[model samples]
Target: MSDEQQVGIVLVSHSGPVAESVVELARGLAAGGVTAPVAPAGGLPNGGLGTSAELIGRAAASVDRGAGVAVLVDLGSAVLTVKSMLADGDELPENTRLVDAPFVEGAVAAVVTASAGGDLAAVEAAASEAYGYRKT
Candidate 1:
């Protein structure tokens, strides 16, 4: 269950399992350490490989807590789909943002920040900063 007081997160990807795995991985990375609401908007309603505006919208709404929603997407079409939704301005929540960050790294960062009671901007920054992560 979501905390309903922190920023929400949405993960968008071309593959259903991949997106779902990221959500599980992110939450596990938090390790019972976070209350951030994370939803996966992957593939299509029919389980095909593609992005769906409906899924994205529903995912965004699923996690909306009035704090805001930070969306992390994988690859091209996912980005395009999110961008289109944001442009429409009605398909998603009022404060939903398409975070410009790495998929897995950013999801971890975003979830942690949001669970820590960070606000919308703070969560977005944390996720965006994940792009600079170094494993070397």
Candidate 2:
């Protein structure tokens, strides 16, 4: 993939399984091998229901391919934790962004867009747009 399409993705949730499931679903939606790196940073180190800045920071770094990273969080705390993580550390890509979108739908949209060679902004927009999706 081109540099513009190499933007990575991070999924953060209070539950580990929830974050992982989103990754799985997004991967399944991808046409071929995932175009960008995707990782799940969820739960505390002890596996409890909580957010961890350390984990999120690491996940962001792990997926970063120099194109940037888009993080989708499930809860308010998740957002705070992710922000704190990114702020506290210098590991995340310089263009990393914490997206405001639904956990599952946003992840699905972001992953698909990223895999299709969309830039960071495009991928982020795709995730955010999920907020207006209708199920009629």
Candidate 3:
């Protein structure tokens, strides 16, 4: 599926490297092939180890494709930053959703679903399922 029809993905983390690594891993793990836009929003602009609202906002805007955006956050403050943006109702693009799931797992699931041309709801569901994932 073309990127235009696939939901965009944003990975937010307190560490910049962690966010970027998750994006790379998710794209690599997508079975259907990743055609959707995925970007990493992490850390402060000065390379500190904390979430930044400005960076998160920019990343969401960067990957927006009119198909909606699935944002997966890696830490507590990261979630808060995203929530603030959502509450504002204007910091991000239209149809942007802050997915509540494990950072790495959710990001991979979201990308896989989006790669298969899944809509926002489907992608969110797939990612949410990761919340119950277990290894035994």
Off by over 4 Å in 2: 1-5, 31-33, 86-91
Instruction: Put down candidate 3 lDDT per residue, 1-136, tens digits, no spaces.
Output: 3445779899999999999999999988885567888999988999999998888889989988888999999878998888988998588999999998898999999998888889999999999999897987
lDDT of each residue in 33-136, candidate 2, tens digit only: 67778999989979999998778888888988888899999887998877776688675668999888888989989988888888888998999999898999
- Candidate 3 residue pairs in clash (backbone atoms < 3 Å): none
Report the lDDT of model 1 for residue 83.
Answer: 94
Return model 1's CA RMSD, one decimal.
2.4
Q: Which candidate has the top score in lDDT? A: 1
Greater lDDT among 2 and 3 belongs to 3
lDDT assessment of candidate 3: 0.89
Q: How do all the candidates rank in terms of TM-score, highest first? A: 1, 3, 2
lDDT of model number 2: 0.86
Top model by TM-score, which number? Answer: 1
- The Cα error of candidate 2 at residue 64, in Å, is 0.6
